[model samples]
Target: MTITINTSEIPDTATEADRALKAKHAAMWASGDYPAVATDIVAALGGVLVDTLDIRAGHCVLDVAAGTGTSALPAARRGAVVTATDLTPELLDLGRASAAEHGLQLSWQVADAEALPYDDGAFDAVMSAIGVMFAPHHQQAADELLRVCRPGGRIGVLSWTPAGFIGQMFAVLKPYAPPPPPGASPAPLWGSGDHVRQLFGERVTDFVARERSLPVTRFADGAEFRDYFKRNYGPTIAVYRFIAGDPDKVAALDAELAALGDRFLAEGVMHWDYLLVTATRA
Candidate 1:
Protein backbone atom coordinates (compact mmCIF):
# COMPACT_ATOMS: atom_id res chain seq x y z
CA MET A 1 0.00 0.00 0.00
CA THR A 2 1.01 3.60 -0.64
CA ILE A 3 0.01 6.87 1.00
CA THR A 4 -0.50 10.32 -0.56
CA ILE A 5 -1.49 13.69 0.88
CA ASN A 6 -3.56 16.22 -1.02
CA THR A 7 -2.87 19.98 -0.90
CA SER A 8 -4.91 20.88 -3.94
CA GLU A 9 -7.82 22.45 -2.13
CA ILE A 10 -7.39 26.19 -1.55
CA PRO A 11 -8.43 27.66 1.76
CA ASP A 12 -11.43 30.01 1.63
CA THR A 13 -9.36 32.91 2.93
CA ALA A 14 -6.49 32.21 0.54
CA THR A 15 -5.32 35.08 -1.61
CA GLU A 16 -6.43 35.03 -5.26
CA ALA A 17 -2.81 34.91 -6.44
CA ASP A 18 -2.16 31.90 -4.29
CA ARG A 19 -5.04 29.96 -5.76
CA ALA A 20 -4.10 30.91 -9.31
CA LEU A 21 -0.51 29.83 -8.86
CA LYS A 22 -1.52 26.51 -7.38
CA ALA A 23 -3.74 25.81 -10.32
CA LYS A 24 -1.07 26.79 -12.82
CA HIS A 25 2.08 25.07 -11.59
CA ALA A 26 0.17 22.07 -10.27
CA ALA A 27 -0.68 21.33 -13.89
CA MET A 28 2.68 22.28 -15.36
CA TRP A 29 4.82 20.32 -12.93
CA ALA A 30 2.48 17.38 -13.32
CA SER A 31 2.22 17.34 -17.13
CA GLY A 32 4.43 19.47 -19.37
CA ASP A 33 7.15 22.04 -20.19
CA TYR A 34 10.21 22.80 -22.32
CA PRO A 35 12.66 20.07 -23.23
CA ALA A 36 14.58 18.12 -20.58
CA VAL A 37 17.47 20.42 -21.57
CA ALA A 38 15.63 23.31 -19.91
CA THR A 39 14.91 21.07 -16.95
CA ASP A 40 18.61 20.16 -16.79
CA ILE A 41 19.51 23.83 -16.65
CA VAL A 42 17.30 24.20 -13.60
CA ALA A 43 18.88 21.15 -11.93
CA ALA A 44 22.37 22.42 -12.70
CA LEU A 45 21.50 25.78 -11.19
CA GLY A 46 20.92 24.02 -7.86
CA GLY A 47 23.82 21.57 -8.22
CA VAL A 48 26.23 24.51 -8.41
CA LEU A 49 25.38 25.26 -4.79
CA VAL A 50 26.32 21.79 -3.57
CA ASP A 51 29.95 22.76 -3.03
CA THR A 52 29.16 26.01 -1.24
CA LEU A 53 26.56 24.40 1.03
CA ASP A 54 29.05 21.61 1.70
CA ILE A 55 26.52 18.79 1.93
CA ARG A 56 29.32 16.28 2.44
CA ALA A 57 29.06 12.49 2.21
CA GLY A 58 28.14 11.73 5.80
CA HIS A 59 25.74 14.46 6.86
CA CYS A 60 21.97 14.12 7.07
CA VAL A 61 20.08 16.65 4.91
CA LEU A 62 16.45 17.56 4.33
CA ASP A 63 15.49 17.95 0.66
CA VAL A 64 12.31 20.02 0.75
CA ALA A 65 10.18 19.74 -2.35
CA ALA A 66 12.51 17.04 -3.53
CA GLY A 67 10.54 16.70 -6.75
CA THR A 68 11.36 13.38 -8.38
CA GLY A 69 14.61 13.52 -6.38
CA THR A 70 16.36 15.63 -8.98
CA SER A 71 18.29 17.25 -6.14
CA ALA A 72 17.60 14.54 -3.59
CA LEU A 73 18.99 11.62 -5.59
CA PRO A 74 22.09 13.51 -6.58
CA ALA A 75 22.83 14.33 -2.94
CA ALA A 76 22.37 10.66 -2.03
CA ARG A 77 24.79 9.68 -4.79
CA ARG A 78 27.33 12.16 -3.47
CA GLY A 79 27.19 10.38 -0.05
CA ALA A 80 24.87 12.55 2.06
CA VAL A 81 22.08 10.46 3.53
CA VAL A 82 18.90 12.29 2.44
CA THR A 83 15.34 12.67 3.69
CA ALA A 84 13.19 13.73 0.73
CA THR A 85 9.80 15.20 1.52
CA ASP A 86 6.98 16.56 -0.61
CA LEU A 87 3.17 16.70 -0.64
CA THR A 88 2.92 15.08 -4.04
CA PRO A 89 2.99 11.29 -3.86
CA GLU A 90 3.02 10.35 -7.56
CA LEU A 91 6.18 12.36 -8.03
CA LEU A 92 7.74 10.40 -5.21
CA ASP A 93 6.95 7.16 -6.95
CA LEU A 94 9.12 8.36 -9.78
CA GLY A 95 11.87 9.26 -7.35
CA ARG A 96 11.60 5.98 -5.45
CA ALA A 97 11.92 3.95 -8.62
CA SER A 98 14.97 5.88 -9.71
CA ALA A 99 16.61 5.55 -6.31
CA ALA A 100 16.13 1.80 -6.27
CA GLU A 101 17.82 1.53 -9.66
CA HIS A 102 20.82 3.53 -8.47
CA GLY A 103 21.01 1.85 -5.04
CA LEU A 104 20.45 5.12 -3.21
CA GLN A 105 18.45 5.31 0.01
CA LEU A 106 16.24 8.36 0.59
CA SER A 107 13.93 8.34 3.58
CA TRP A 108 10.69 9.27 1.82
CA GLN A 109 8.00 11.07 3.71
CA VAL A 110 4.78 12.91 2.86
CA ALA A 111 4.66 16.04 4.93
CA ASP A 112 3.92 19.75 4.78
CA ALA A 113 6.64 22.32 5.29
CA GLU A 114 4.36 24.45 7.46
CA ALA A 115 3.88 21.50 9.81
CA LEU A 116 6.98 19.34 9.78
CA PRO A 117 6.62 16.21 11.95
CA TYR A 118 10.33 15.95 12.66
CA ASP A 119 11.92 16.85 15.98
CA ASP A 120 13.76 20.10 16.52
CA GLY A 121 17.40 20.22 15.47
CA ALA A 122 17.10 17.03 13.43
CA PHE A 123 19.05 18.07 10.35
CA ASP A 124 22.57 19.22 9.60
CA ALA A 125 21.30 21.16 6.56
CA VAL A 126 17.96 22.22 5.05
CA MET A 127 17.59 23.11 1.38
CA SER A 128 14.83 23.94 -1.06
CA ALA A 129 15.22 24.82 -4.73
CA ILE A 130 12.42 26.89 -6.23
CA GLY A 131 10.06 25.70 -3.48
CA VAL A 132 10.09 27.86 -0.36
CA MET A 133 8.55 30.75 -2.26
CA PHE A 134 5.50 28.70 -3.13
CA ALA A 135 4.65 27.57 0.38
CA PRO A 136 1.34 29.27 1.28
CA HIS A 137 2.46 29.85 4.81
CA HIS A 138 6.03 30.91 4.05
CA GLN A 139 6.77 32.31 7.50
CA GLN A 140 5.67 29.15 9.22
CA ALA A 141 7.47 27.05 6.64
CA ALA A 142 10.68 28.99 7.22
CA ASP A 143 10.35 28.53 10.94
CA GLU A 144 9.82 24.82 10.47
CA LEU A 145 12.77 24.53 8.12
CA LEU A 146 14.80 26.29 10.78
CA ARG A 147 13.36 24.11 13.53
CA VAL A 148 14.60 20.94 11.86
CA CYS A 149 18.04 22.34 11.06
CA ARG A 150 20.59 21.91 13.84
CA PRO A 151 21.56 25.15 15.59
CA GLY A 152 24.94 25.27 13.88
CA GLY A 153 23.69 23.87 10.57
CA ARG A 154 22.52 25.80 7.49
CA ILE A 155 19.66 26.55 5.09
CA GLY A 156 20.06 27.35 1.40
CA VAL A 157 17.37 28.49 -1.04
CA LEU A 158 17.69 29.19 -4.76
CA SER A 159 15.15 30.97 -6.95
CA TRP A 160 14.93 32.71 -10.32
CA THR A 161 15.53 36.45 -10.27
CA PRO A 162 12.62 38.50 -11.54
CA ALA A 163 13.99 40.59 -14.44
CA GLY A 164 15.90 40.07 -17.64
CA PHE A 165 14.81 37.06 -19.71
CA ILE A 166 13.00 35.08 -17.06
CA GLY A 167 11.03 38.16 -16.04
CA GLN A 168 10.63 39.52 -19.57
CA MET A 169 9.39 36.25 -20.93
CA PHE A 170 6.59 36.30 -18.39
CA ALA A 171 5.89 39.96 -19.20
CA VAL A 172 5.48 39.41 -22.94
CA LEU A 173 3.28 36.42 -22.24
CA LYS A 174 1.32 37.90 -19.31
CA PRO A 175 -1.20 39.57 -21.56
CA TYR A 176 -2.14 36.29 -23.13
CA ALA A 177 -3.26 35.14 -19.70
CA PRO A 178 -5.51 36.37 -16.92
CA PRO A 179 -4.65 39.15 -14.50
CA PRO A 180 -2.44 37.85 -11.67
CA PRO A 181 -3.92 37.58 -8.23
CA PRO A 182 -1.88 39.25 -5.50
CA GLY A 183 1.08 37.27 -4.07
CA ALA A 184 1.00 34.74 -6.88
CA SER A 185 4.68 34.28 -7.60
CA PRO A 186 5.34 32.54 -4.30
CA ALA A 187 8.34 30.25 -4.89
CA PRO A 188 10.57 32.82 -6.43
CA LEU A 189 9.56 34.67 -3.25
CA TRP A 190 12.90 36.18 -2.38
CA GLY A 191 14.48 37.23 -5.64
CA SER A 192 16.21 40.45 -4.65
CA GLY A 193 13.91 41.05 -1.73
CA ASP A 194 14.38 42.12 1.89
CA HIS A 195 12.40 39.11 3.05
CA VAL A 196 15.65 37.17 3.24
CA ARG A 197 17.17 39.64 5.68
CA GLN A 198 14.09 39.84 7.86
CA LEU A 199 13.14 36.16 7.83
CA PHE A 200 16.57 34.68 8.34
CA GLY A 201 17.90 37.41 10.61
CA GLU A 202 15.47 36.48 13.35
CA ARG A 203 16.01 32.74 13.03
CA VAL A 204 19.65 32.11 12.02
CA THR A 205 23.01 33.85 11.73
CA ASP A 206 25.62 34.46 9.04
CA PHE A 207 23.15 35.18 6.29
CA VAL A 208 24.71 35.72 2.85
CA ALA A 209 23.71 36.23 -0.78
CA ARG A 210 25.31 34.64 -3.85
CA GLU A 211 24.61 35.18 -7.55
CA ARG A 212 25.03 32.66 -10.35
CA SER A 213 24.50 33.10 -14.07
CA LEU A 214 22.43 30.07 -15.06
CA PRO A 215 22.48 28.82 -18.66
CA VAL A 216 18.97 28.53 -20.14
CA THR A 217 17.51 28.32 -23.62
CA ARG A 218 15.00 30.81 -24.93
CA PHE A 219 12.02 29.92 -27.11
CA ALA A 220 13.24 29.44 -30.68
CA ASP A 221 11.13 32.46 -31.50
CA GLY A 222 8.71 34.49 -29.39
CA ALA A 223 5.88 32.40 -30.83
CA GLU A 224 7.53 29.12 -29.96
CA PHE A 225 8.11 30.34 -26.46
CA ARG A 226 4.53 31.53 -25.92
CA ASP A 227 3.26 28.03 -26.55
CA TYR A 228 5.49 26.90 -23.74
CA PHE A 229 4.04 29.69 -21.57
CA LYS A 230 0.39 28.70 -22.06
CA ARG A 231 1.17 25.44 -20.35
CA ASN A 232 3.68 26.82 -17.86
CA TYR A 233 2.37 30.25 -16.85
CA GLY A 234 -0.48 30.34 -14.32
CA PRO A 235 -2.58 33.23 -15.53
CA THR A 236 -2.29 32.26 -19.16
CA ILE A 237 -3.90 28.90 -18.55
CA ALA A 238 -6.80 30.59 -16.74
CA VAL A 239 -7.07 33.09 -19.59
CA TYR A 240 -7.16 30.45 -22.30
CA ARG A 241 -9.58 28.39 -20.26
CA PHE A 242 -11.84 31.44 -20.04
CA ILE A 243 -11.52 32.44 -23.69
CA ALA A 244 -11.44 29.12 -25.45
CA GLY A 245 -12.86 25.80 -24.46
CA ASP A 246 -10.33 23.10 -23.57
CA PRO A 247 -10.08 21.13 -26.81
CA ASP A 248 -9.56 24.07 -29.15
CA LYS A 249 -7.60 26.12 -26.58
CA VAL A 250 -4.40 24.10 -26.66
CA ALA A 251 -4.36 24.29 -30.46
CA ALA A 252 -5.17 28.00 -30.25
CA LEU A 253 -2.33 28.48 -27.77
CA ASP A 254 0.08 27.16 -30.34
CA ALA A 255 -1.30 29.57 -32.89
CA GLU A 256 -1.06 32.53 -30.52
CA LEU A 257 2.47 31.73 -29.32
CA ALA A 258 3.52 31.47 -32.93
CA ALA A 259 1.95 34.87 -33.53
CA LEU A 260 4.13 36.59 -30.93
CA GLY A 261 7.56 35.12 -31.68
CA ASP A 262 8.89 38.25 -33.38
CA ARG A 263 8.49 40.37 -30.26
CA PHE A 264 10.03 37.85 -27.78
CA LEU A 265 13.03 36.61 -29.68
CA ALA A 266 15.08 37.96 -32.51
CA GLU A 267 17.89 35.91 -30.80
CA GLY A 268 18.62 35.61 -27.10
CA VAL A 269 19.07 33.05 -24.36
CA MET A 270 16.26 33.36 -21.85
CA HIS A 271 17.92 35.18 -18.99
CA TRP A 272 18.12 32.98 -15.89
CA ASP A 273 20.03 34.75 -13.12
CA TYR A 274 19.56 32.53 -10.12
CA LEU A 275 19.58 33.87 -6.58
CA LEU A 276 21.21 31.80 -3.87
CA VAL A 277 20.30 32.75 -0.30
CA THR A 278 22.25 31.14 2.53
CA ALA A 279 22.02 31.40 6.31
CA THR A 280 23.69 29.59 9.18
CA ARG A 281 22.70 29.35 12.83
CA ALA A 282 24.44 31.75 15.17
Candidate 2:
Protein backbone atom coordinates (compact mmCIF):
# COMPACT_ATOMS: atom_id res chain seq x y z
CA MET A 1 0.00 0.00 0.00
CA THR A 2 1.17 3.51 -0.83
CA ILE A 3 0.94 6.32 1.76
CA THR A 4 0.66 9.92 0.68
CA ILE A 5 0.90 12.84 3.12
CA ASN A 6 -0.73 16.11 2.23
CA THR A 7 0.53 19.13 4.16
CA SER A 8 -2.06 21.35 2.46
CA GLU A 9 -4.17 21.03 5.56
CA ILE A 10 -1.68 23.05 7.62
CA PRO A 11 -3.09 26.46 8.43
CA ASP A 12 -1.77 29.12 6.04
CA THR A 13 -1.55 31.48 8.98
CA ALA A 14 1.07 29.36 10.71
CA THR A 15 4.43 31.11 11.05
CA GLU A 16 7.55 29.87 9.34
CA ALA A 17 9.01 29.11 12.75
CA ASP A 18 6.09 26.82 13.52
CA ARG A 19 6.56 25.02 10.22
CA ALA A 20 10.24 24.45 10.87
CA LEU A 21 9.63 23.12 14.36
CA LYS A 22 7.01 20.70 13.09
CA ALA A 23 9.35 19.49 10.40
CA LYS A 24 11.97 18.73 13.02
CA HIS A 25 9.34 16.92 15.06
CA ALA A 26 8.31 14.81 12.10
CA ALA A 27 11.90 13.83 11.33
CA MET A 28 12.67 13.00 14.95
CA TRP A 29 9.71 10.66 15.34
CA ALA A 30 10.35 9.09 11.97
CA SER A 31 13.99 8.38 12.79
CA GLY A 32 13.34 5.32 14.95
CA ASP A 33 10.91 2.40 14.97
CA TYR A 34 8.34 3.97 17.34
CA PRO A 35 5.59 1.51 16.48
CA ALA A 36 7.63 -1.32 17.93
CA VAL A 37 8.14 0.58 21.17
CA ALA A 38 4.47 1.46 21.37
CA THR A 39 3.30 -2.07 20.65
CA ASP A 40 5.72 -3.70 23.06
CA ILE A 41 5.45 -1.32 25.99
CA VAL A 42 2.28 0.76 26.06
CA ALA A 43 -0.25 -1.00 23.85
CA ALA A 44 -2.69 -1.67 26.70
CA LEU A 45 -3.05 2.03 27.53
CA GLY A 46 -4.92 2.55 24.27
CA GLY A 47 -7.69 0.21 25.35
CA VAL A 48 -7.73 1.82 28.77
CA LEU A 49 -8.30 5.26 27.24
CA VAL A 50 -10.92 3.90 24.85
CA ASP A 51 -12.87 2.38 27.73
CA THR A 52 -12.50 5.56 29.76
CA LEU A 53 -14.27 7.50 27.05
CA ASP A 54 -17.01 4.87 26.85
CA ILE A 55 -16.84 5.13 23.09
CA ARG A 56 -19.94 3.63 21.47
CA ALA A 57 -20.66 2.50 17.95
CA GLY A 58 -21.18 5.30 15.44
CA HIS A 59 -19.52 7.91 17.60
CA CYS A 60 -17.04 10.12 15.80
CA VAL A 61 -13.62 9.87 17.44
CA LEU A 62 -10.36 11.65 16.71
CA ASP A 63 -7.02 10.39 17.99
CA VAL A 64 -4.53 13.24 18.02
CA ALA A 65 -0.81 12.58 17.62
CA ALA A 66 -1.85 8.96 17.44
CA GLY A 67 1.26 6.86 16.77
CA THR A 68 0.25 3.57 15.19
CA GLY A 69 -3.37 3.97 16.36
CA THR A 70 -2.84 2.63 19.84
CA SER A 71 -6.06 4.14 21.27
CA ALA A 72 -7.56 4.73 17.87
CA LEU A 73 -7.54 1.06 16.83
CA PRO A 74 -9.25 -0.03 20.04
CA ALA A 75 -11.89 2.65 19.63
CA ALA A 76 -12.45 1.46 16.07
CA ARG A 77 -12.75 -2.11 17.31
CA ARG A 78 -15.56 -0.95 19.57
CA GLY A 79 -17.30 0.36 16.43
CA ALA A 80 -16.57 4.04 16.83
CA VAL A 81 -15.87 5.98 13.68
CA VAL A 82 -12.16 6.64 14.24
CA THR A 83 -9.72 8.95 12.51
CA ALA A 84 -6.12 8.82 13.71
CA THR A 85 -3.87 11.81 13.07
CA ASP A 86 -0.15 12.28 13.62
CA LEU A 87 2.54 14.75 12.64
CA THR A 88 4.78 11.98 11.29
CA PRO A 89 3.41 10.41 8.14
CA GLU A 90 5.60 7.35 8.55
CA LEU A 91 3.91 6.46 11.82
CA LEU A 92 0.47 7.02 10.34
CA ASP A 93 1.35 4.83 7.36
CA LEU A 94 2.37 2.01 9.66
CA GLY A 95 -0.86 2.51 11.60
CA ARG A 96 -2.93 2.28 8.43
CA ALA A 97 -1.20 -0.96 7.53
CA SER A 98 -1.86 -2.37 10.99
CA ALA A 99 -5.52 -1.41 10.75
CA ALA A 100 -5.80 -3.18 7.39
CA GLU A 101 -4.17 -6.31 8.79
CA HIS A 102 -6.61 -6.36 11.67
CA GLY A 103 -9.54 -5.68 9.32
CA LEU A 104 -10.36 -2.50 11.22
CA GLN A 105 -11.67 0.41 9.17
CA LEU A 106 -10.45 3.92 10.00
CA SER A 107 -8.95 7.01 8.45
CA TRP A 108 -5.33 8.06 8.99
CA GLN A 109 -4.21 11.62 8.36
CA VAL A 110 -1.09 13.73 8.84
CA ALA A 111 -2.03 16.59 11.18
CA ASP A 112 -0.60 19.03 13.66
CA ALA A 113 -2.09 18.79 17.13
CA GLU A 114 -1.75 22.53 17.76
CA ALA A 115 -3.75 23.32 14.64
CA LEU A 116 -6.14 20.49 13.82
CA PRO A 117 -7.90 20.75 10.47
CA TYR A 118 -11.31 19.47 11.53
CA ASP A 119 -14.26 21.80 12.10
CA ASP A 120 -15.25 22.75 15.60
CA GLY A 121 -17.32 20.15 17.42
CA ALA A 122 -16.80 17.64 14.63
CA PHE A 123 -16.27 14.71 16.96
CA ASP A 124 -18.14 12.94 19.74
CA ALA A 125 -15.04 11.89 21.63
CA VAL A 126 -11.47 13.23 21.15
CA MET A 127 -8.48 11.46 22.60
CA SER A 128 -4.70 10.99 22.65
CA ALA A 129 -2.65 8.29 24.30
CA ILE A 130 0.95 9.21 25.01
CA GLY A 131 0.40 11.57 22.13
CA VAL A 132 -0.51 15.29 21.68
CA MET A 133 1.44 15.97 24.85
CA PHE A 134 4.52 16.27 22.70
CA ALA A 135 3.14 19.19 20.74
CA PRO A 136 5.36 22.27 21.17
CA HIS A 137 2.55 24.35 22.56
CA HIS A 138 0.42 22.77 25.28
CA GLN A 139 -2.34 25.38 25.41
CA GLN A 140 -2.79 25.37 21.66
CA ALA A 141 -2.99 21.60 21.59
CA ALA A 142 -5.48 21.59 24.49
CA ASP A 143 -7.59 24.23 22.75
CA GLU A 144 -7.61 22.20 19.55
CA LEU A 145 -8.72 19.10 21.45
CA LEU A 146 -11.55 21.04 23.08
CA ARG A 147 -12.51 22.80 19.85
CA VAL A 148 -12.95 19.55 17.90
CA CYS A 149 -15.32 17.87 20.34
CA ARG A 150 -19.05 18.60 20.55
CA PRO A 151 -20.70 20.05 23.61
CA GLY A 152 -20.88 17.50 26.40
CA GLY A 153 -18.74 15.14 24.34
CA ARG A 154 -15.86 13.32 25.96
CA ILE A 155 -12.15 14.30 25.77
CA GLY A 156 -9.47 12.00 27.08
CA VAL A 157 -5.67 12.29 27.34
CA LEU A 158 -3.10 9.82 28.55
CA SER A 159 0.46 11.05 29.11
CA TRP A 160 3.71 10.24 30.85
CA THR A 161 3.79 12.11 34.13
CA PRO A 162 6.62 14.45 35.16
CA ALA A 163 7.75 12.01 37.84
CA GLY A 164 7.37 8.83 35.84
CA PHE A 165 9.97 6.64 34.21
CA ILE A 166 9.58 8.31 30.84
CA GLY A 167 9.73 11.74 32.37
CA GLN A 168 12.88 10.93 34.33
CA MET A 169 14.43 9.59 31.18
CA PHE A 170 13.81 12.94 29.49
CA ALA A 171 15.29 14.70 32.47
CA VAL A 172 18.48 12.73 32.08
CA LEU A 173 18.58 13.67 28.40
CA LYS A 174 17.78 17.37 28.86
CA PRO A 175 21.25 18.68 29.69
CA TYR A 176 22.66 17.26 26.48
CA ALA A 177 19.73 18.44 24.33
CA PRO A 178 19.45 21.63 22.37
CA PRO A 179 17.20 24.49 23.46
CA PRO A 180 13.50 24.02 22.72
CA PRO A 181 11.48 26.15 20.33
CA PRO A 182 10.38 29.51 21.67
CA GLY A 183 7.41 29.48 24.08
CA ALA A 184 7.21 25.70 24.14
CA SER A 185 6.55 24.09 27.48
CA PRO A 186 7.74 20.68 28.60
CA ALA A 187 5.56 17.86 27.25
CA PRO A 188 5.22 16.15 30.61
CA LEU A 189 3.30 19.16 31.90
CA TRP A 190 0.25 17.68 30.19
CA GLY A 191 0.46 14.86 32.68
CA SER A 192 -0.20 17.25 35.52
CA GLY A 193 -3.86 17.82 36.54
CA ASP A 194 -3.33 21.45 37.41
CA HIS A 195 -1.52 22.23 34.19
CA VAL A 196 -4.18 20.58 32.03
CA ARG A 197 -7.00 22.30 33.93
CA GLN A 198 -5.27 25.59 33.50
CA LEU A 199 -4.94 25.03 29.79
CA PHE A 200 -8.63 24.11 29.33
CA GLY A 201 -9.67 26.93 31.73
CA GLU A 202 -13.45 26.59 32.13
CA ARG A 203 -13.80 25.53 28.51
CA VAL A 204 -14.29 22.03 29.88
CA THR A 205 -15.87 20.51 32.97
CA ASP A 206 -16.54 17.35 34.96
CA PHE A 207 -12.83 16.71 34.82
CA VAL A 208 -11.44 13.45 36.18
CA ALA A 209 -7.79 12.46 36.52
CA ARG A 210 -5.90 9.35 37.52
CA GLU A 211 -2.35 8.05 37.58
CA ARG A 212 -1.58 4.52 36.49
CA SER A 213 1.56 2.45 36.13
CA LEU A 214 2.42 0.24 33.17
CA PRO A 215 4.60 -2.63 34.27
CA VAL A 216 7.62 -3.24 32.03
CA THR A 217 9.29 -6.62 32.19
CA ARG A 218 10.85 -6.67 28.76
CA PHE A 219 14.33 -5.71 29.96
CA ALA A 220 16.43 -7.75 32.30
CA ASP A 221 18.19 -4.66 33.68
CA GLY A 222 18.85 -0.94 33.19
CA ALA A 223 21.41 -1.33 30.39
CA GLU A 224 19.04 -3.47 28.36
CA PHE A 225 16.26 -0.95 28.84
CA ARG A 226 18.56 1.87 27.75
CA ASP A 227 19.68 -0.06 24.69
CA TYR A 228 16.08 -0.81 23.68
CA PHE A 229 15.04 2.83 23.83
CA LYS A 230 18.10 3.96 21.90
CA ARG A 231 17.09 1.65 19.08
CA ASN A 232 13.31 2.05 19.12
CA TYR A 233 12.28 5.32 20.79
CA GLY A 234 12.47 8.41 18.64
CA PRO A 235 13.18 10.97 21.33
CA THR A 236 16.00 8.89 22.75
CA ILE A 237 17.40 8.34 19.30
CA ALA A 238 17.14 12.06 18.56
CA VAL A 239 19.09 12.90 21.68
CA TYR A 240 21.78 10.49 20.69
CA ARG A 241 21.91 12.00 17.21
CA PHE A 242 22.50 15.50 18.50
CA ILE A 243 25.40 14.40 20.67
CA ALA A 244 26.85 11.89 18.27
CA GLY A 245 29.98 13.92 17.40
CA ASP A 246 31.21 13.94 20.98
CA PRO A 247 32.11 10.53 22.34
CA ASP A 248 32.25 11.92 25.90
CA LYS A 249 28.72 13.33 25.67
CA VAL A 250 27.42 10.10 24.19
CA ALA A 251 29.07 8.09 26.94
CA ALA A 252 27.59 10.40 29.58
CA LEU A 253 24.12 10.02 28.14
CA ASP A 254 24.47 6.27 28.03
CA ALA A 255 25.56 6.11 31.64
CA GLU A 256 22.83 8.43 32.90
CA LEU A 257 19.99 6.71 31.04
CA ALA A 258 21.12 3.30 32.14
CA ALA A 259 21.31 4.46 35.74
CA LEU A 260 17.79 5.87 35.52
CA GLY A 261 16.44 2.56 34.32
CA ASP A 262 18.30 0.76 37.07
CA ARG A 263 16.78 3.03 39.68
CA PHE A 264 13.26 2.32 38.36
CA LEU A 265 13.73 -1.42 38.08
CA ALA A 266 12.28 -3.52 40.88
CA GLU A 267 11.81 -7.27 41.12
CA GLY A 268 12.41 -7.91 37.44
CA VAL A 269 9.96 -5.20 36.35
CA MET A 270 9.76 -1.43 36.04
CA HIS A 271 6.45 0.33 36.41
CA TRP A 272 6.09 3.39 34.20
CA ASP A 273 3.65 5.98 35.47
CA TYR A 274 1.21 7.92 33.30
CA LEU A 275 -1.62 10.32 33.85
CA LEU A 276 -5.09 9.71 32.42
CA VAL A 277 -7.47 12.62 32.23
CA THR A 278 -11.07 12.65 31.03
CA ALA A 279 -13.43 15.56 30.71
CA THR A 280 -16.53 16.91 28.94
CA ARG A 281 -16.70 19.89 26.61
CA ALA A 282 -18.72 22.69 28.12
What would the per-residue lDDT of candidate 1 be over residues 1-282, giving only the tens digit for each residue?
112233343224445665565555445554543224325446675465466688889888888866677677777888887888866665677779888999998888865566666767778888877666656566767787888888999888776666644544445445556655553444444666476667665777778877666644656666656666666544355566666756665675566556555443445654466678888965
Model 1 misplacement above 4 A: 1-28, 33-40, 168-185, 229-239, 242-268
Candidate 1 displacement at residue 278 in angstroms: 1.0
Q: Which pairs clash (backbone N, Cα, C closer than 3 Å) in model 2?
A: none
Per-prediction backbone clash count: 6, 0
Best by TM-score: 2
Local accuracy of candidate 2 as per-residue lDDT tens digits, 114-171: 8888877888899999999999889889999998899999999999999999988888
> Which stretches of candidate 2 lie above 4 Å from their native place?
1-11
Q: Work out how many backbone clashes candidate 2 has.
A: 0
Provide the TM-score for each candidate, comma-separated.
Answer: 0.75, 0.96
Q: List the residue pairs that clash in candidate 1.
A: 133-186, 133-187, 134-187, 222-261, 223-257, 223-261
